[model samples]
Target: MALLLLFASPLTLAFTLEDLKNQLSQPAVVTGPFIQEKHLRALPQPLQSKGRFVLARDHGLLWLLQTPLRQDYRITAKGIARRDLSGWQTLPSTSAATEQNRLFFAVLQGDSSGLQRDFDLDLTGEPQHWQLRLTPRSLLLKQVFTHIDISGARFVERIELHETQGDRTLLRMPESTSAESLDDAERNDFAE
Candidate 1:
């Protein structure tokens, strides 16, 4: 039964898309610390920034920066709201920008159906530690982002975004923060 044994061994290690989807557990809101480094085409060194973000499945993302400089971004039904020295202002919501933001949130929030519509996915590694590489399908999306790669050990720990203009951004959110109910900051963002 040596031939039978060989066939059985290979079957045991095969991992499917369903398996990866199950491995990713998306909470209603996942709050975590983040370190984002933007590598620009003209910049000699990558610009680093430290922040915290809240990812909500129904609402949107609340990104806050408390160090180096202060910045806040709240992505809600209205649009992407950014807070500067003046105050909170909503940016224009172009179709491309909206889709790009939704795609990022969908991938992180484990919305399998949303991801499947716009991206062709290739998953590598294993259940414990794995990578999901996405190639954009829509011509509009291709104009913005070339590819997106996400990796984690249980939860999503990192995201690398490659853009069409040759700029890249690497965001690390390895540390798990409180997944409890949305705080006051988060509540106000969605309320608006």
Candidate 2:
């Protein structure tokens, strides 16, 4: 649930940010499944949820959570929306929220400039598998998130979010492919 960033460049001795960005050179669309696990300090067991997501490069992302509870989230250039028993509700346009959204959109586009603007970026691991670690440098982001780590090969496979409040969320997208054969719902998911 973070930057879907990757690079297409060749991997040499060391994996570079340029390489990651290039690997993620935009595909028309990305559709996949995601598993989210949350560990709360107040609670002993981790909360687990599994779902699917569709990321359309030209539009935005449609993230659906089915287990634990059913929830559908949409992130567009304008803002974030969640579907519940009622309907879509726009999230408040706070600076932190904006930064988070930018992280998602930029990651999908392999645009790290926005990410660099908000976090202390660190690139490590090898090309076959690499990790992008981001530490919040801004006071606003720091208040909410301590750090975010995204790791994968050709696509974003895992996202680890560390919150300053002692809660952590692990989002893993094990499989993903170019959505060249999008169905009616997916084809129009991001239009609105």
Candidate 3:
């Protein structure tokens, strides 16, 4: 009877969209390293980049790249910004860029409602492990993305972007840790 109770506990916590949002949103901050590979049809090899990222629930994402080149980017509801000698400079936001940024934030923040407005979401599996596929419902997004697949455990683990032009971008976050709040440096970066 005890064994049966132990085994059924996990199953009782069945996964649902709200459950996923709750799991993801419980963490105030998530920090990790990322490996991104962009596969282009015209290129023989995929372009790869390594970076560290900070995702603050109240703030935004800070992507610091250290690879073939070094660059920093901050993505917030306002827009995308790049770091340079002068400091954080806001990039010109195109419609496509705006849509992409919105998508990224929605996925990371578990804003399923935000995502539903633009794409048809198909989610499967349980809480500890699950997959989400986003099929573009909007004409503009359809031209840019074939579909987007995101899977994770406690936090998002990987994102696979399928482009309409036969290009693909795969992003992997092998390790992620959650925190109650951002560090001083991270908080300052978000402020900039």
Q: Which ten residues in a row have the lowest lDDT in candidate 1?
A: 19-28
For residues 1-192, write the lDDT of model 3, one tens digit per residue: 999999999878767777888888889999999999999999999999999999998898999999979999999989999999999999999987897888898898778888999999998998778999999998988998999999999999999999999999999997999999999989888887
1-192 per-residue lDDT for model 2 (tens digits): 233233423333566677777777657778788998999999999999999998876677889988877888899888998876776788789876876788887765556777788788898877668888889888878898989888887788888999999999998999988766567876555554
TM-score of each: 0.81, 0.82, 0.91
Looking at model 1, the pairs that clash are none
| Residue clash pairs of candidate 2 | 6-20, 6-21, 6-24, 7-20, 7-21, 7-22, 7-23, 7-24, 8-22, 8-23
- Deviation in Å, model 2, residue 145 alpha carbon: 2.7
Residue 82 local lDDT, model 3: 97
TM-score of 2: 0.82
Q: In what order do the candidates fall by lDDT, top score first? A: 3, 1, 2
Q: Give the TM-score of candidate 1.
A: 0.81
lDDT of each: 0.81, 0.80, 0.92
Off by over 4 Å in 2: 1-14, 84-92
Instruction: Give a tens-digit lDDT track for model 1, residues 1-192.
Output: 999999898778876567766655445677889999999999999999999888876788888997788889988756798976776789988987787687767777655678989889888788778888889898877887899999886668999999999999999998955464788867876776
